[model samples]
Target: MSSTAAFYLLSTLGGYLVTSFLLLKYPTLLHQRKKQRFLSKHISHRGGAGENLENTMAAFQHPPGLPVYGIFQARTMEWIAIPFSRGVISAVTIGTDMLELDCHITKDEQVVVSHDENLKRSTGINVNISDLKYCELPPYLGKLDVSFQKACQCEGKDNRIPLLKEVFEAFPNTPINIDIKVNNNLLIKKVSELVKQYRREHITVWGNASYEIVEKCYKENSEIPILFSLQRVLLILGLFFTGLLPFVPIREQFFEIPMPSIILKLKEPHTMSRSQKFLIWLSDILLMRKALFDHLTARGIQVYIWVLNEEQEYKRAFDLGATGVMTDYPTKLKDFLHNFSE
Candidate 1:
């Protein structure tokens, strides 16, 4: 075909592709409104639960099976696994049903789950956790100086880095949320497969989701609760071609707003503005993300804010009508829910 003819053919095909994508993705998002309302109505806002412990980035273990909120722990976390696991295992053992972790592949392609694309902060060693072979990798506990005997509480137990499969085997019925750290489609596919092998109840997944990875996920299994965050979608569009992100049929858009940090305080310079802060979510958004959050929530998709550690902010997240707030301390969330419901 002539160059002009080839160009025309490709352009026509691309238009058809974009149309098909919008119809699939947007409608699923719209339909989620009823589900969102149901979730909002019944889920708790406060519990009479006791005073809670401070948590780090690793595991936020609560007792299993209570549907409070998913505990978030980053794989790129700096705390050693033993001390980390002490917290993580404790986080889950209490009552939390879900955990979010960052998953990436090493240079050898073994999946080493962690959040940062760079590992310098977490490992304190000069390396990307994703770029090292399992053997070349140092004992992770060495960095934290936490002894395995104390962390695992076993005389002869090994403290090697836990595998993706091992987590599934060890914690039956444990719900997981995996955030893909790299742009590898094949790696996401393998992780998806492993999720299927051990998935007993439900799983949630998110990522920077290069088009290839999200596309592969939807084509293979549509039932897994995949989230297409509004902020992330707009981000990918800005970063890549507009023609790309629309191809995936996403049922939910996880609009995550992290609780305030020193970084936020530095920029905005306010304290009582937390309710304002929860709405100030999408700090990464250079655009009007709050307007987008209202639009999405109005349509019925859930908007979950993360790490609502303080009582005032937790109350504000609910008062402002958020779908859910993720917390390191589910006990506090339960108390908030019970009191709110009363």
Candidate 2:
């Protein structure tokens, strides 16, 4: 505890604090901004699930003269008969900046765009997607409940499951965010191959929150941008609180996270147990740090908050420096963005 030793210690601490503050405020001083090919502010969750059937071809575009049968025979025929020359309403037609969908592998090794691994919730079939062949897969329920927005139901003309390759062919130029629902290596490999075959490396982003799954995806194709895994997210938060985020290098280009406030509001607060409510509150406090978001944005990392269907939630996300908002109701979000100022 000599005077000279104490003086040097204090000087070092002061220098570290000053450097950390500067880096926090201006991240580009140390880290170069990453150049991303596609940036989206309005991302459609499950191809605008609230508006359509949730990841059906009909949700993405008007089905071209496809024959209709069963319950949709009368209703679907009217919409399906419309010529492609005439403008039709769909998720793509409505102008979503990006499509956020989940992927699961069929028994035949084909990649399908779906939100659930089990078919019961979406299709009312008691089977896992992995156990069925592409042809054996059941159709989605005609009237489906939206996951993010409770009690809300959506209907679409085409309820058949769509292959990932089909989506790529249909929307060649659109950006897609694929969430790998399982740890299946084959699923990851197939998705990567499709992205490569379509030459959509720049516009397509894929990954799961599992660290192991994210690592496999990166290994499969490092060219495609990956989303942050849960472990990495925790690590980043740690670095931010420790004032070391500026000194660290970030490889993932996209950070897709949920808005905690939205979660609290989605389920009735009175219905939640005290512990559940406290956890949500804790997440709100930890994850809604404006300084952390600003630093990440400065480093050219796009931050997207998820499943925010309301206008106020969208405003909060943007005000917190989020680059994008993923919503089940893309049309609602688009309108909000249109009328929103600043």
TM-score of each: 0.56, 0.90
Looking at model 1, residue 311 earns an lDDT score of 58
Could you give candidate 1's per-residue lDDT for residues 92-139 as a string of tens digits?
444454555567677777765554556554446677766678677643
Local accuracy of candidate 2 as per-residue lDDT tens digits, 1-342 = 999999999999999989999999998888899997978999988887776789887767633332221111222222222234444555555658898889999999999999899999888989999999999999998889888887788777788999999999988999999999999999999999999999999899999889999999999999999999999999999999898888999999998898887777679868999999889889988998889998998999999999897777888999999999998776567667766752
Best by TM-score: 2
What local lDDT does model 1 show for residue 109?
Answer: 70
Candidate 1 CA-lDDT value: 0.48
Each candidate's clash count: 23, 0
* Clash pairs, model 2 backbone: none
Q: Give model 1's TM-score versus the native structure.
A: 0.56
Candidates' lDDT values, in order? 0.48, 0.85
